[model samples]
Target chain A: MEDTVEQPKAHGPHGYSARKDDHVKRLRRIEGQIRGLQRMVEQDEYCIDILTQVSASTKALQSFALSLLEEHLRHCVADAVEHGGPEADDKVAEATAAIARLLRS
Target chain B: MEDTVEQPKAHGPHGYSARKDDHVKRLRRIEGQIRGLQRMVEQDEYCIDILTQVSASTKALQSFALSLLEEHLRHCVADAVEHGGPEADDKVAEATAAIARLLRS
Candidate 1:
């Protein structure tokens, strides 16, 4: 906790920083889809219809994830690999774990 | 559009009508999570942390879909099967299609 308490700024920006606005826009749209699902439920819409929306929202979230993952590989992982050290391995491993989680979900 | 415009009341209500409040509540929570993700991106939170949250949100969406699907099977599909007609086949096929879409998404 002591050493990790540095600060977000200490790392400059994250891999996603370059596409921050795009990410935020995509998230806001996903939020709208969630709200739409709530409305469909409240209105007693057809079950299959609601499920379809769920699928769309899930896809959108995954798409956003893919974008973030690409940026991560391009910037963070690439940078780490360039440095040629133990941290490079950790970065790639961390990214792999995140991909595994996404796939399982 | 003609047949579909018959009104939602024509079908009574969907299978999820039984747990309307629960579904709405879950959706609202998911919506909150999406907003949190947006904030994370805006704040330049770590890429890994954002990806982790995306996985959580995606998982939650899928969970909601599963719940809706279960109710659809227990109620709508069951009713159609009990009636013993072509509609039963249609219901089963529709559900299968929905599941496939979810998988691909």
Candidate 2:
């Protein structure tokens, strides 16, 4: 039984916990907005109107991603750089890859 | 004026373009499903039914995240490990932080 007990998960360098609730709340609201868009489509709403809603929802997601990225840079990347070693290089490369993906989208 | 010319964005090691279309398509479907859930609520649909859709939608998002993670590991992480340098370390750290956020959610 003792062996079966799971160790706690490690938190990331970034203070993700600090903004976790806020991020979740924003996502939930975005979820609601998505639902609204579906309703508009079903009820024969204007095409432009539906498109507008879609654009808005996409923007919300992008904004959320940006904020998360900022947090990662400020905390995780900063920590790794301060440490100054192979691990520091790893963190920067990892972040660069992520940023590339985001921009490509 | 020459400086104003925007350089093309760099690609991530993972070849994100290889599956970018697939990811976008899945997201669009998820968006549609979200709309459906909204309609259910608006029409006073049963609580359980709406909850179920929400669950499904959430699962879809999770799956998408998993796929993206897989791609990152296969391409970006693998490349970094092979490179065996400071950049490699940075990439791994970046990815570790991302996984942490995903798991926390």
Leading candidate by lDDT: 1
Which residue segments of model 1 deviate by more than 4 Å?
A1-12, B1-12
Model 1: docking quality category:
medium
What candidate 2 gets wrong by more than 4 Å, as runs, is: A1-14, B1-105
Candidate 1 positional error at B3, Å: 20
lDDT of 1: 0.88
- lDDT tens per residue, model 2, A1-105: 112236232323133434655655666677777667545534434323343454566556556566666766676667768889999898777777666554444
Candidate 2 C-alpha error for residue B105, in Å: 25
**lDDT (10s digit) by residue, model 1, range A10-89:** 24477777568788888989999999999888887889999999999999999999999998998889989989899999
Give the per-residue lDDT of model 1 (tens digit) for B2-82: 134454642447777757888889999999999999999888888889999999999999999999999999889998999
- Each candidate's lDDT (Cα)? 0.88, 0.57
Question: In model 1, how large is the Cα lDDT of residue B46?
Answer: 85
